[model samples]
Target: MRPFAFERAPDLAAAQRVVALSASSRAETVPAMLLAGGTTLLDLMKLDVLRPERVVDINALAGRFGGVAAEPAGLRLGALARMAQVADDAGVRRDYPVIAESLALAASAQLRNMASLGGNVLQRTRCSYFRDVSHAACNKRNPGSGCAALGGCNRQHAVLGTSDHCIATYPGDFAQALVALDAVVEIEGPQGARRLPFAGLHRLPGDRPDEETVLRPGEIIAGFLVPAGPWARRSRYVKVRDRESYAFAAASAAVALDLDGDRVREARIALGGVATIPWRAREAEAALAGQVLDEAGAERAAAAAFREARTHGDNDHKPELGRRTLVRALLEAARMEI
Candidate 1:
């Protein structure tokens, strides 16, 4: 790993000040980077993909930020709360099974114990070209340089939110759950605090693929707020990967449904491992509204979900796999004994 200045931030204000002082126009290229779980940050740094001149340790602030509270109204998850803690919480597992399941299915037990909820959502893509510095072409790592994955081995790349500039998939399970549940993200920055829809946290890989998120420079994700809703109780996340465990998803779906007898009252669907950002399938939800929850309705909703998917050479099967995953998740959620 590259040698850099290290400082432990005593509080949120201190952490913000350090980052804001070194903030640049582009968030990815910021000279000073925050250190939370260090799962993603340190990996990229060791790979030479990220070369921040300074590393600010924010664990000291965890005392004020790390807690999981589940109430009748909603769930409040502190950004610094460890993934394992939240996943194992009785309230989370009982009340928000989708959220708990997503976390439980991610990474290994060790990583889940160390990774923070805030850092987990902000984890970067696992594109080989982006991680391997030897590969000179990756738009996410280098702006306007070009995307090698376009013509190279891209079976793992995205299909739902692909642009000519980039096809790297957002590799997180929790974010999809958040998007499906309409969770709100709390952010603290140099300018002050703000709450944004969790769906709006990630940006599409347009011309500027390097700009992955909408977070302003020097901003720290404070926590997440998931309001209680009918759909929250009957939800599920289905992930299809190359392996059963400790592998990134090839196609995954987070489904939450509120049923009116055998008919659908509301449906919320977010797809992961197939999009540039946490993708909410509004079209799919529309198709299922007021329809009977059955195999035919699930098929129609799945088709609507991937209608806009654009795939390159090796990843042509992604759309179909994504559709099947969504169908399975919806069916499983319908069977939930909520």
Candidate 2:
């Protein structure tokens, strides 16, 4: 890892000042990086993928943005709240099982204990080429260079949202839950605080695959707001991987259903591990809007989910795998007694 300076910010204002200083300094190749749990930043740094000149520690700001609370309107999750805290919260477990289950199924207990909700959502892709600095063809790592995954072994890469420049998959479990529930992300920066749809946070790899998010130069994610809904309790997240534990999903689905008798009143669907971004399968949700939860309906919804999925060589099976995963999740959610 490259030598870098580290400093801790006591408050949000101090953090902003540090960011401003870094932005003004032309010495650093990249802007100042934020350090929360160090789960993502440290790993990339050690790999020499991210050689930031300065890292601003934000753990001190937890007291201001690290609480999980249940509000009458919805659930509010502070960005710094640990994954374990949010997953084990009674309110989250009971009210938003998809969110809890997604967190519980991610990483190991040790990582869940250390990683924060905000950091987890912003985690980088797991593409081997992108992580290994030896590969000089990863567009995400070095923009305008090239993408080796497009012609190489890309079984774990994305199929849904991909550009010629990059095909790295969005590798987060919690973001799928947030997208399915239509959660809103709260961000604070030097300009001010703003709320945006969770779906809008991630950007597709158009030309500049390196720019992964819509966050401004100095914006930091503060918290997430998941609105309360009749379908939240009946939600489920199904992750399909080569192995059960400690493996990233090959294809995963977060599904929520509000049923009137045997017919669906409303259905929400989001897919992960097979897309460039947290993919909300709105077409599939629409297919099940008034349909009964039967085999035919499930198949139809699944087909709709992957209707627009584009796959490369090795990942050609992902569309089928993703379809099956979503179908199973929808069926299971339909039977859930919420």
Candidate 3:
């Protein structure tokens, strides 16, 4: 919308240098953004929500970081890998159905083809207030101003991991799968390379709702590492929405189960669409371990997932909806022939 300079980065080092220069000099109010797929960044820019003075196009670096590898150790997904490529990979579909399903069920076919895995996880909230510049009270768009969703139309906002400062939900489905699988995010920055737990990448909308991820100023996501586990083969992602197509989730669950003759040996649960972040339900997993995988156990686990959920007036039904979604996903995953 506004005038901005753009350059195609030949490599990661060049991209990092551009970001460093932008940070050192306060020439732009917003930090220089690295453009991969441009699915999220471009959309926000069009909405006038993000106004970076410069954008570093990183597609040139994809040749070096876009490969997807399936190894005996685990799965390694390059951050630059397209969603469609990862979703349709035979190895991913076979061993990590939840990951594939999450990517496939996201946005649409066109978006999946263009969106990168790294950018997908970093997608911003789809809250109307945050997208519409007319709404001057969005805490995420304008920090310390106010959260319009707090007492306004909040039926689509978060019920879990919410705070008085903000209630906007993390809208991406893939991040939920990553959280459930205990994926590690590889990041590179001016300092050096580092790996972070995928679950720890996103921050709660605590007092600073504007500050979302734990990424440093110039950090770029290199890839994601998912450890191979017995449950990975029996995982699935279930989403509930207002429509069958192109609709954001109102409630969703990523469930991975390992059963030992009708008894649960291990379970991993992560909730989306009803939380402020990619929410891992460790309490729910604890409830399912050693328990028989049945309707009663599923319900118990679902209850544990939403045990601390607090909702506003309009979204008061989310906790119940989230529980039902989790229950259904667990049952579906349990029935899978793994």
Candidate 4:
């Protein structure tokens, strides 16, 4: 809303140079956040949450920067790839079913068409305290001031990987599915282009809830690399909300199972709406390995995943919801053939 300069970038190199030249003097070099469809950024700016000095539009790089490729090696999704494109793509709906389902389950049709893959992955949590200017005590929005969610009405706060300083949940469905599949992100910056496993891309809030991702100041996400794995073909993303119509997940699970004659050969599980970040449930996978996929087995696995969950008052029901969501997701995934 405030006065800020805007420029449409011609290419990645030009975009990179524009960012470097504009932001080099700042302590952290990226002067302007690359603007895609501006769904998240613009929303924040309107709310006065984020007021970047400049806006760099990558509209011209659409064709050259966005596409989804299905290969023997894996799936490659360009950074500028639109959410609707990936969500509705036949390859995504057929092969990476969980990914498609997750995308379809988020926001709305218009926002999905406008939002980009990279922007969605980097979107911040939707904590109420962090959004309102009156509640500037939020540690995520303003560090060391105080945490409003600590004792405030926080039913949607995180249950896992939470510190006293912060407990805001990572509000993304697609990231959960991708992390479940062990997806990797390709990034380019001042140093050069490189790849990072999805698990390494996110960071725990720790004491500094201000910092979220591992991305440097001037870095840009290039693409997402999904390894051709057993779970990619047999996966399900299940979300549970209060009303179930364009609502954020109260508890969700992204589950992929490889079953062998009623026994689990392998499984990949990640939980959202219950963690500080996209939570990969290695414990749940371990519990399912070599075990059956019956109701009892699913319950056991779900319980294992939430075994270490430390929840607070008013939202203690999340652990139970997380367990039920996982159990249901596992059953749905087990039923899927190919």
Candidate 5:
């Protein structure tokens, strides 16, 4: 890792001040970064993909930030709460199966124990071009330089939210669940706290792939709030990866369905591993609403979900695979005992 100064933040305010003071004029570059799990941040730093001048440890504030509360109103998950803790919580497993399943299926037991919910959502792409300094052309790493994955080995790249500049897929399962459940993100910055829709947290790689999330400099993710809904209970997350363990998804779907007998009252679908961001398939949901929760309806919804998918040569099969994954997830969710 590169040489850097470190400090343990005693409180939220102290952490914010350190980052805010070191903030760069560019949104993509922050001189100081807050550390929670250090799962993603440390990895990037060692790879020389991220070179922060200072690292602020925020675990000292975990006493106030790490919490998992489930009430009739909704589910509130603190930013510092470990992935394993939230995934193993009885209320999360029972009431928000999709959320729990996503976390359970991610990384390994050790990573789950260390990774925090806030850091997980903000995790960067696993694109080889971006990670390796040898690859001289990675728009995500060095903006406007070029995108090596655009025509190179791009089977793992995105299809749903591709742009001329970049196609690196967002590689997190939890973000998809949050998007599907319409969770709200609580952000604490130097200005104070504010809430934003989870779906809006990530930005598409339109022309500037370097500018990923909508978070400002010195901003820290405080928590997540998922409202209680009938669809939340009857939800499932299906991930298809190259391997059974410690592998990233090739195509995955998070499905939440609210049904009335055999008919669908509502459907919420968020796609992962095939998009630049946690993709919410509103068109797919529209197709399934008021329709019978059957194979035919699922097929139609799946088609709608990938209608706008644009794939390069190596990843041409992603759209079809994504469609099948969604179909399978919807069918499996329909059969859930909940």
Candidate 6:
């Protein structure tokens, strides 16, 4: 890692000042990245993946942005809120089952406690080529360099929303669940505060595979507001992996459906492990609307989920795997009866 100066910001204003200073100092616009729990960021620094000239420590502002508050409309999860705190909170478990399940099914207990919700959402994908410093052609790590995963070892890469340049998968379990619940993120930047839908946060790798997020210069996510809806309670995050333990998803689905009598009233679906972004199955959702939850309906919904998937090479199996995962997720959510 390259040597750099480090400082702690006592409040949001001081943090903004630090960022502004970095931006104006002939560095990259929004030059300094905020330092949170150092779970993922520090590791990248050590790997020479991110060599920031200055690191702004936000630990002092931790208490201000790490609280969970429940409201009639929905829950507000602060950006600095620890994963363990949100996952184990009774309100999250009772009100947002998908969020709770996703967190509980993620990394080990230690990581969950150390990693914050915001950091987890913004975490990089686990693509091997993207992580390896040896892979000089990783487009995600360096723009216009090229993508080795295009025709390389890409069995674990994304199938949906892929491009000729990149095929890396989105690798967060909790974000998938949040996408299912239609969460919106609040961000503060030089342009002032703005709210962005969770779906809009990530971008598909078109030409600039390096730029992944919708965040502008110096924009930092403040918190997340998951809109409370009918399906928030009756939700489940089903992950199918190589193992049943703490492993990344081979195919995962987060489904939240509101059952009215024997028929589906509303459905919110987002998939992981098979897409470049949180895959929202709008067709599958439409297929299940006003339909009874039966074997046929489940299969139809699952099939519709992958209607437009553009799988190729070794990832051709993902469409089917994703279908089954969604079906299983819907079935699991139906059993919730909440």
lDDT tens string, model 2, 1-338?
A: 89899889889988776656555533315667778888888998899888788899999999989989998799999999999999999999999999999999999998899899999999999999999988899888787889999999999999888999999999999999999999999999988999999999999999989878887766788999999999999999999999999889999999988999889999999999999999999999999998898878999999998988888899999999998998899889988887
**Candidate 2, clashing residue pairs?**
none
Per-prediction TM-score to the true structure, in the order listed: 0.97, 0.97, 0.97, 0.95, 0.97, 0.94
**Per-residue C-alpha lDDT of model 5 across residues 86-162, encoded as one tens digit per residue:** 99999999999999999999999999999999999989999999999899898888878899998799999999988
Off by over 4 Å in 5: 25-30
How much does each candidate deviate from the true structure in C-alpha RMSD? 1.3, 1.7, 1.6, 2.1, 1.4, 2.2
User: Candidate 6 lDDT (Cα, whole model)?
Assistant: 0.85
TM-score of 3: 0.97
User: What's model 3's lDDT at 297?
Assistant: 93
Q: Once superposed on the true structure, which residue ranges of model 4 sit more than 4 Å away at CA?
A: 17-31
Whole-model lDDT for model 4 versus the true structure? 0.87
**Total clashing residue pairs per candidate?**
0, 0, 0, 0, 0, 0
The candidate with the higher lDDT, 1 or 6, is: 1
lDDT of 1 at 5: 90
The 10-residue segment with the lowest total lDDT in model 3: 22-31
Score each candidate by Cα lDDT.
Answer: 0.93, 0.91, 0.91, 0.87, 0.93, 0.85
TM-score of 4: 0.95
Deviating ranges (above 4 Å) for candidate 2: 19-31
lDDT of 3 at 312: 92
Pitting candidate 1 against candidate 3, the one with the higher TM-score is 1
Cα displacement (angstroms), candidate 4, residue 127, comes to 0.4
Local accuracy of candidate 3 as per-residue lDDT tens digits, 89-129: 99999999999999999999999999999999989999999
lDDT of 1 by residue, 1-338 (tens): 88899988988888887667655734334578889999999999889888888899999988878899988889999999999999999999999999999999999999999999999999999999999989988888878889999999999989988899999999999999999999999999888899999999999988999887888867889999999999999999999999999999999999999999889999999999999999999999999999999999999999999999999999999999999999999999999997
